[model samples]
Target chain A: MSHSLQHNRRLFLGALGAGLFTTRGAFAEQLLASPALTEGPFYPDQLPLDRDNDLIIINDSLTPAVGEITHLTGKILDASGKPLKDALVEIWQCDANAVYLHTADSGPKKDQQDKNFQGYGAFTTGSTGEYRFRTIKPVPYPGRPSPHIHVKVSQKGRELVTTQLFIRDHAGNLQDGVFLGLRDILDRELVVSDFEPMKNSKMGELACEWDVVIGRTPDEREFERS
Target chain B: MRRVLALSAAVAVCLPLLNSALRAQPPGAPPQGGRGAAAPNAESFLQRLMQYDANGDGSLTLDEVKDRRLHALLNRADANEDGVVTKAELTALHQKESAAIGRQPAGFPPPGAQQPPGAGRGGPPGAQPGPGAGPGPQRRGGRAGQILPEFVQDELELSPEQREQVAELQKEVDAQLEKILTPEQRALLNQPRPGGPGGRQRPPGAGPGRPNGEIREN
Candidate 1:
């Protein structure tokens, strides 16, 4: 029932946002800012040699980054808040084992879990800001107190926003400075539905859905294009 | 000799129309108003294999597969708000992704498997008389990063002279983006260009080109 209620709220909010965006202008560049990818401690040491953006990177010979396999999903909208069908959305994350592709991740091998985790994923927005991912659920580790995911939004080549996601109701949320520092609302925004047991089992069988709200449109000058 | 002349006349008459039809194909794939493809939801697969796999050794564990954290992530991912991810949802997602800072896997086609209406999609030139005439839906696809040619032009209200100043600022931003990514990511984006008039087929090694070309050409 928790999933059902959260699902309904998502539907309701999307409808409201879309209803508002539609009555205003037919071509108002989407109102929501570019979706953001949450920055994590682990990105990638160097870009993958193959660099095809495959998520699972445990085996150099094998493709697709391997991780917990979390399925991510959500929507996009305009200011008047209509679902911006066909808008673009992108995402990237630390591969499993907490290593990122950023310079900050240049530490020794002992600190890393999955040396092969490419730590990133991307998907375009459908007719709505709605997007989905077949990925591993974020895992928590030492140093960084919370588990989160990074995201980015776009239309064509222009980038809209970059942001991150936090584990809802995680005890670490309070301890993690970054997670705690977000605006009260944005922090609260992370609380999604709880992990209900899929009819199969409770441990591995889990479903999580997160919705991100950006404050601008795809063509805005304020949003960074890089 | 008379028969040869007749056959030559037939070829001369048919070739021009064929050429024109061929030229019309490039723009026809992407529908103007709206065109789309739909995919079956992977939910049932989750139910059948992952969720129902009581042993939970190799298959997706029902718990690991579903979580509130992931529920929220998925809520954000399911852009269409149709409850379940339809095939159109997958295509919509594919179209929005930029192939630069991050990208989707090559083999991971959208649910509908609407082949990219290009040389990649198995529909090479001369294979179809016109774009939309093929079996798949007319897909209005475009490249990412379709910005005005000049970086300085990005900021409005600046005089031509100030444009150069804006370019400098833009350079700073690019440099910053470069800094943010690892050496490898930068190399992927700045991969050396290929030599040719048709850079579109830049071998996968040509580096991540700005996918925005769809906007300019369309």
Candidate 2:
């Protein structure tokens, strides 16, 4: 089959599978809550001047970050599938060279940090509880085998959850100490999202969609707070 | 291209089936023998520094660095002031910085300290901060540093002293605004307003607290 023909078939099959999964109410009961992960120490101490959703470029600079460009989109939903609007979504990760924005991480190795990468970006959800960001595919550094993005969601001055998103089926995930910390396989499934290639994207840009489900009940919230 | 697409499609189709199968199994015991933190060594330090060798040369000139902060930092490492930072000079600077870090008290890995990969995830015990080490009792996600919007400062061409004064004035204005509103209304103001760009108004006194920014160790 030709490339475009194969792409169409994959899209059709993906749509069919999605439709089948949603219609089956049996799977609804198994919607695993997104487990909160450690907010790694590398969060930027002094944020960059450009704090927008597009991490690839900083403040109208023509140069882009050196990495596989990724278009990350997601929704903040409650456990019962209700959209939580007006929530703030934030993501931070190390640059392609494995240097983070935090002074603690990059201060000693400033030369290695990617200058173009914003390193951190934020988006606030509208009525649809949707958020989007343009960033690079995370790369693994020494000691941490799995490449991941750290995420935090807050609403109305109260924090909802802090978690990390992993690339689905990446071989490094098995070796990562933090990834293994989540003992439950279902919880692991909730955090991992596929970094699929964007159809017809000339830049080889990837698209990732990962929904974050906030715990609603007091009991669940207490569990997530850990 | 065809093979890659076919493989992705196969993985996509099999994923749901794999998920279902895994869901049926009981939770397995957590894995043991967590990987220890990789000790920082000189060879790795040189390898990381060489990434800036744009022309595949052994040394780095100021022009090779794109990051402004890095340019400034690397400029200081030029020991002989020859406008070029050679591998030996970088090694010397790294050793000096490492020695400085060694002298600091053990906790929180002070600002310039080297943090091992996965070190943040409870890997090393001594580096972890005690309760007393944290930034003292502040509001979670509270706007601590910033006060004036960047545009306002730029347009006014305010000096550093003037900026500080303006921040104080803004805080006073926020205090006055708080007095005007009822407690419930104040809480409503704190809620993020949805819509256009202008809609994101800084609430009274509540500057954009590091909402999705820094996750300070509590």
Candidate 3:
């Protein structure tokens, strides 16, 4: 009887340990691979009032952001280099005033926040698995770990991956553990951004091209999950 | 025994015809603005169309055709936006999408932007081409780049402003990238190097994927 009881206890402990580890692993598996970043506290709690193609502007309000506007474009290819058609990419960021769309964003007051920044935008990949977004260049925000762009990729109502794109030249990268962990070239392959001269204006245009590689193998599942 | 043999012969004779008659192919190419991949036998476009088929009907409706989810994709293959997608169109769209899906996040364009005069292409999804002349497969040699040379300079051509616009966008990202990433990461970038457990080398001949399709590095 003692032996049988011991066996049952061992089984119970194993099951309990498995559950605990699973929970921890799910929430904290480390974000690497895909250059896309997290939405952070900037994702709008509610949709913007004036939802245009331009994320740089919140509504049709007269003034746009004082900072440079960027045209972020790129294609999503699989490891095999094939394009994943019909994919959806969502991105969010802080406005020029260092304010995000989230409730926690710091500013003197909520309404006082710069309403010109669109804060978030979505683009659907066409047959070429290519997508584009219009927004302002991400500026430094107070107390944030680094200047980063949070992104999410999805297809057929299923979330494929959500990660952050660290600014390659940011001084904070060395300090950020996540960025350091992705030191390898493949880990940082998509971490790219380029600046272009403005058209008929003083401020130049900012360009960003990120090639995201979604995990197709079974091993890729762990990284893709939130 | 004789009757059973006769029935077996009848079943055998009908099977091949049924298989050929109801193939699960993509609707052929759309009428306008179609990329070369969607021109004929690609598989990706059919997958998107299948998603819109809510009631399992063999055809598409205005609602299915106009689904905003499919706007960018369907537009690539639809050409004229007449709302009906065919198998030939589906093939090209699929091939195009598959390549795009694999492309690096740099701006890539659609294929078939240009064609050698009368060089032959795929059909609209389900619509058969001229007698004995179906849309040929993999005519681009392989997925060269996202933007076809023809389209990049033609009807779907990128205006000088657009090109400048894209270049400026790249510049902005480059600034941010320089400011954000470590010198080590940046060094490895734009050049191939040793990798980690994740595997570094992007295998060659990715079997018709993106990173090509006219995403020129200039």
TM-score for each candidate, following the candidate numbering: 0.37, 0.45, 0.40
- Give candidate 3 regions above 4 Å deviation: A1-39, A106-112, A181-185, A196-203, A218-226, B1-218
Candidate 2, residue A164: CA error in Å? 0.3
How accurate locally is residue B146 in candidate 1, as Cα lDDT from 0 to 100? 17
Candidate 1 chain A weakest ten by summed lDDT: A217-226
Error of 1 at B54 (Å): 46
**Prediction RMSDs, each to the true structure:** 25.0, 24.3, 22.6
lDDT of 2 by residue, B1-218 (tens): 99999999777655543332232111111111111222233444455345456676678777765322245446657999999998777666655443332222112222322223322222223332223222222212223232544222322224334545665676687778878889898787665334211233334434223111111111
The weakest ten consecutive residues by lDDT in model 2 chain B span B26-35
lDDT of 1 by residue, A1-226 (tens): 6964664455344433333332212322322232232333344445445433235543365654445555566665543355555556555554455444555542432343354555555566666568776555554332233456666555555444455566666544433334423312212344333433344554354455665544322211111111
Please tell me what DockQ candidate 2 reaches. 0.01
Pitting candidate 2 against candidate 3, the one with the higher TM-score is: 2
DockQ of model 1, rounded to 2 decimals: 0.01
TM-score-better candidate, 1 vs 2:
2
Ranking by lDDT: 2, 3, 1
Task: Give the number of the best model, judged by TM-score.
Answer: 2
Best of the two (1, 3) by lDDT: 3
Tens-digit lDDT track for model 3 on A1-226?
6864664454334323322332222312111224333334456778666555578655656777545677777776653356788888887776555556776552333553556667778888888999887776665333232355667777776566666565554444432323332322223334534435445655467776666655332212111121
DockQ of each: 0.01, 0.01, 0.01
